[model samples]
Target chain A: MSDDNQHQETFEDFKNSFNYGSRSDLNFKFLKNLSGEDASHFFQELLWKIGDSFNDGDFTRVVDHVNETQAKAYAGVGRFTYDDSPFTPLRAPLSQLRLGLMTSSGHFVAGDDPKPFGVENMSQQEAETRIDDFLKVEPQLSVIPMDTSIEKLRVRHGGYDVRASMADPNVNFPISRLAELQAEGRIGELASDAYSFVGAASQLRLLNHTGPEWVRMFQEKKIDALLLVPV
Target chain B: MEAGGIPTVVIGVHAFRDRLAAMRLPRTVITPHPMGRTLGAPKDDETQKQVILAALDLLETAQKPGKIIDLPGRYRL
Candidate 1:
């Protein structure tokens, strides 16, 4: 079969795997006409557009057309809301304050014996399948020292695709860029280590407990400001 | 982090703008990119650095909480 035919078959198989309801608007015939790379990009963009609708609660318009199980899941996926917005002004000049980097991109230094968040030895496929199970696991933070090279990092996350991050850890964890900024004196000093966690985990635990604990860790490290990059 | 007295600024994608708004994070810079590639396409150093710089700038300039700045750029790769 031709490459285009194979891609079309794959796309059809993927579509059949999910219950997209009676949403005829999802017909992606145009995708089959594009090159593989362009098709992949368009598909990702489509998913994000759908995700935005879900987040905005606009997906309800098609909820009735979807199966009961899918409809229930959609209804349950409400965005979390907090009662207050917190703010802390920078304590010192940017040229003098120590800075830290953190990400929800599920990254860890390569060759680490025990991976952070109990994701050691977990494959991307397994991670995707165990999303809910992973969410139940206690949030674990991995420390990546500032000196570690980007090539020495690996990503494993159940929440979203990790291909982009695996190719360039800076896509979500911009440690190298932060270091460059430090070198240019744009920031005072980069913290000795950066942090990462699987953002797919329980937000309640994070907000009430793990998050505070992480903040305390940052405090102990004397980090003046934090830059969070969430995947 | 703001409540803990260590200021924080989030560099996130625009797709999650609603969720981010709901979370009431201290400070944020929204980039028009996909979920996985939050900064930009892989290996796109220029765009990635720009996003980082934007977040850093927000850290220094943001005077209040819940400030979500839309970064003016798209994924270049």
Candidate 2:
């Protein structure tokens, strides 16, 4: 057989092997054991811990008693540690899926683009001056197309040792590797853009707003799946 | 947001495993590495590629929500 025929046959074989029915069949069976009475008890225990083990303290009193660090810690526990959200399943075959990347580490390529995703091209001093405002107005989701040069990339995360990523952006946002996979046919294709967010943000309001907005943007980009690298 | 209809697989540090579990994330693969280097040591292409592939594999094989799998190996500073 000719090379084109062999390639077509292999592609067909892959599609046939993919579990397309898995999406419709998707169910939250992971939480099956935590139901009814058990679930109620579990949530109560979680809540108690988040409230700083409150037994008989007034809300105002509790707020006044805890330090800033303690307050933030408890607040996060109360806000994020919940299992009530719904989940979608991966139904497409790995070979046929279009993948996107998101990093909690604030890494982006610098350039003179009107897209206010990251502080691109400015000196570190200038970027630091504008970082707060940049984070504010910039959309919760930023799109990064593949083939963006590594030379243009920079890491702006304050919460960790960024030296590694500074030397090589792929340490955090491995777009180069993703491109290789695409070329090798290990995956279908990459979305035109990837995304970035500062994971160190402590404000629940900001996260609560941005998280779903990011999801909507991902869906808009027609991404079939996402690989999130969280620092 | 997995519950919101996106299938997300997280490659994160082990330090955040408990918190990630609480957040009820979809498929998660944890490495005993520090915060910033989620893929592996910087410029270590082979290791990074292996790690990325493993996380994608988790996206396919993970059966339920909040599934956390430990990837083999520790990343030293």
Candidate 3:
């Protein structure tokens, strides 16, 4: 019933206290803005999406590409739209689930004396220098590219800057010409909607985790086809 | 694969996750970038079709419960 009582024991204590102690860690962010149950559902959704989308057939080629691209973008179904009701919260063992992960999330856990994923103790003045240093190895993903002709559309999509990485430079900014092509009701013949590679990923793993769900939803809706345009 | 009721398409900007959405009975992957603009608003029908077609391709090939289909050549299509 108490907040601290959720997992009162440390990994060491858990090891000595419970059967799953080795896998348990104190997830600091786990309780932040999370309704426990919804978080659990989200995790369930992760498994389901992978099951429904990953198969051995014509889609074989797509498995890796979609996983890689999205594993680098999106977040938990990218947060439900405003129109929809929020998800439920359930109390579950998050620490036990992420024990073997390479993720920067929940880096501190299960008696290892976890530290916050990134810089934890830098003065405000040194923030820029720190970010610059981090960018050297952990560079940020640019949502928009430099030579993008779809600048206007980027703004239209509701973003401050449309940046992208040099190798995968498919920003959401579609050119006016492309937009024109989409408006004339010509694209739906082959697919449901044209691609718009503009939006920013909330979390790197979100895209990958939520990918199958997107595919399933479109299919269930009888979309017939999809033509990812990649800005 | 007891993923509940009829088939449903799960939409997300990434493919690594969404296991839960897929389990919601039906599932698929999109591997796009942001979640908000899956269809890329303000664009036209042709542009939207690009997103839709790729989605369709997933459904077409998807068979098992945990499929990870990736249309790397999505741009070409």
Highest-TM-score candidate: 1
TM-score (chain A only) for the predictions, listed in order: 0.67, 0.54, 0.22
Model 2 misplaced regions, further than 4 Å: A1-79, A112-140
Model 1 chain A weakest lDDT span, ten residues long = A21-30
In model 2 chain A, where is the ten-residue run with the lowest total lDDT?
A21-30
Each candidate's clash count: 0, 4, 98
Q: What digit string (tens of lDDT, one per residue) describes model 2 on residues A111-168? A: 5333334444444334344445554543344456677888877666534556778887
Worst 10 residues of 3 chain B by lDDT: B1-10
Sort the candidates on lDDT, descending order.
Answer: 1, 2, 3
Q: Which tens-of-lDDT digit does each residue in A100-121 have in candidate 3?
A: 0011111111222211125444
Candidate 2 chain B: worst 10 consecutive residues by lDDT?
B31-40
Model 2 accuracy (lDDT, Cα): 0.64
lDDT of 3 by residue, B7-50 (tens): 22344444224533433323344544332233333333454446
Where does model 1 exceed 4 Å of error?
A1-77, A113-120
Backbone clash pairs for candidate 1 read none
Q: Order the numbered candidates by DockQ, best leading.
A: 1, 2, 3
Which one is best on lDDT? 1
**Cα lDDT for residue A109, candidate 1:** 88
Can you give the lDDT of residue B21 in candidate 2? 70
What CA root-mean-square deviation does each model show from the true structure? 10.6, 21.6, 19.0
